[model samples]
Target chain A: MTHGTTSPHPAEPAPAPRRGRPRDAARDRALLDATLAVLAENGYGGLTTAAVAARAGVSTATLYRRWSSKEELVIAAAALHGESSYEQPGTGTLEGDLRVVLREKAAAMTGEPGRLIRALIGEAAHNTALAEALVTAFLQPLYDRVAEVVRRAVERGEIPPLDGVELLGEVVVGPVMTHFLLTPRLPEDVDQATARETADRLLPFALRAVGGTP
Target chain B: MTHGTTSPHPAEPAPAPRRGRPRDAARDRALLDATLAVLAENGYGGLTTAAVAARAGVSTATLYRRWSSKEELVIAAAALHGESSYEQPGTGTLEGDLRVVLREKAAAMTGEPGRLIRALIGEAAHNTALAEALVTAFLQPLYDRVAEVVRRAVERGEIPPLDGVELLGEVVVGPVMTHFLLTPRLPEDVDQATARETADRLLPFALRAVGGTP
Candidate 1:
């Protein structure tokens, strides 16, 4: 819920008396959507608060009231985008849960969401704030979900207790990340068949890596 | 090696007659090094041919004589940087060889090379040409090396034949790449001890994934 480290404009007037919570929510969503659109079109370097505000059909002052900086706006947009794309799998078995998770993740890594993420990652390389925000907003939640799956399996005696459970996140999703990011094809060209096959193929390795039977 | 798709400036003069082969080699190295430096300092968007030329103390025409565009210059520089950093492992055992390779790659992912790569990946998200060049220059060679190691292991009866061997690259090195890139740490601040520890922890999973005993 924290917008970012920087504070919004203190002098900006409060919302109009007629402006309700639902309208405010709608405005926030519109701004975040505009942010993603801008990121997808221009990448991180080209992103600016002015451009986002203009795209959202809002004044710069309004945008500043919501986000103190472009980086914070990006972080917020990415978080909202990721939540919509990611599904928490509750499938009975570990393998089934992983398959659902991986497939969903691969699907997310294509099209506009993928492009926005790449732009963010590119910025995250040198921008500590963005990097940390990415880890916090995206990676940590994904890791926690994976850890929960592992925890369930351990309780069911499906596998031995893992010593370094944190590493499981990388072991499980790293290949998919590599395939999506390193492959030369445009994200839109990443067909579902390829993602499904990749998920099936790597499932064994993932299971083995986590001390589960394939 | 092919520089890139775009040919050098058609009207540009050839190298001076006094320029010996060694000096030409030295000049190429300097230009590539400067490209890396510029990329490290200013990500992909900020990198310019004039900046690289000025950094290398060469005319823009001289740089153009070698690389036709900023993208091509980046590709050439990245190819050279990857070549010098990558070492083919010849350790007798597969585990030992993988450990060596993983450790070396993790080491390379720290510092200037890492920053430059992050910039390139950022650019690659939107630029098809850069993406293909990255795969050819970096990922392909690494995959080939990993395949060779697997081939050796198969020949020695260390493991059964691996189908879709291409995926091995992602399987073995993907975790390390994820750890380095997504960990939110400044590349320079990535200590050797941490790299070594990550290699050690992921080694068993790598072995298991590759169908070898840990």
Candidate 2:
């Protein structure tokens, strides 16, 4: 949601509601959807309130009334995506648990949700505080999930738990992103097919690197 | 080297040595050193070719002799970081390998070379071709080393290798870079002293994910 080159804190929590007819949740949704659409079609530099208002079929005043700026709207649009609770799979094996998690993310990444996110991350670079907000809103949950799983594995004694599950997350994620970022060959190796393949060749190195044995 | 936005393939490789003083190799080194110094002191957007040339004590023409554009200069600065060699420890154990690599990178990251590289990646979104060049020069060696190790492990039957060594590289590198990119903290688990502790936790999941340990 890091949409602009400015400070990132959300502006005053919607100001506790102005005296208006119950804000149309539908219009809000419409505006967000339109934002995602337009973000994909055009990079962050091109996203405009006029285009979003027109596309959402709402008035400019309606758009402005809710969101103070494009950055706020971008954050809201990003935050609106995927409110699913992380399910801890009690499959007794780490592989099974991670498989379910990675696959779910893969699907989500392949959709409009992922595209909007990519756009946000791209823009965030030129904007620091905004990038922070985007990271908090979009990517933090994924880290939390991976961290919890490693913790659960340690508690279960399925593996000799390390001090940080977060490290495990890094080893798994770093190269995939590096390759994806560098080349256009494959976007993210996030699916069952890629994940399965990753599990086979990389897991050993990662396992040993972390000191867990299969 | 995220030369984002748009790119045209390299402008036909620097047309072979046309007589002018053989392109002062010493001057090239000084300019690169200047580039890193400027990056560390001023950060990315604030960097310029004139500043670099001035710092290096070379004329602007000397600077232009090496790099055609600022993006080109920045990307080259990142590439010429001098951490080119990859060494595999013959500690006869997987944990040993992980320790050497992670510790070295983390330490390197604390210095100018690593910091400058990170800054370049941050700038990747603004320039496309620079990103491409940086990836080719820097991250590729990392990918190659890990991939080679996986190939050896499979051949030795140290672990049953499955598939996708490249993807595995991502899994390993992603979190490390992600943390460095966004936050100051990394998993202490991968610290030089505690690498084995981290490796044990990471191994089984990594191995299983890669398709080994059947």
**Which candidate ranks first by lDDT, i.e. highest?**
1
**Candidate 2 C-alpha lDDT tens digits along B1-214:** 1321222213223234343443455566678789888887888878989999999998888788668888778766665563443555455544444444444555444444545655666566445676676666666666565566556666767767554555655654454455555443322213443433443444444444444442
Per-residue lDDT over A6-43 for candidate 1, one digit per residue giving the tens place of the 0 to 100 score: 32222343344233343555677789899888877877
Q: For model 2, how does the per-residue alpha-carbon lDDT over A107-173 read when each residue is reduced to its tens digit?
A: 4443455455545655664466667676666566666666676668777786775644566555544
TM-score of chain A of 2: 0.71
Model 2 chain A worst lDDT window (10 residues): A1-10
lDDT of 2: 0.58
TM-score of each: 0.86, 0.69
Clashing pairs in 1: none
Q: Cα lDDT for residue B67, model 2?
A: 81
Steric clashes per prediction: 0, 44
lDDT of 1 by residue, B1-214 (tens): 3332332322343354343333555677789889888887777778899999999999999889777888888988887766554567888899998898788788777766676677677668678888888888788878888888888999999988877687889988888888888868877777888878888888888887788877
Q: What is the DockQ of each candidate?
A: 0.56, 0.24
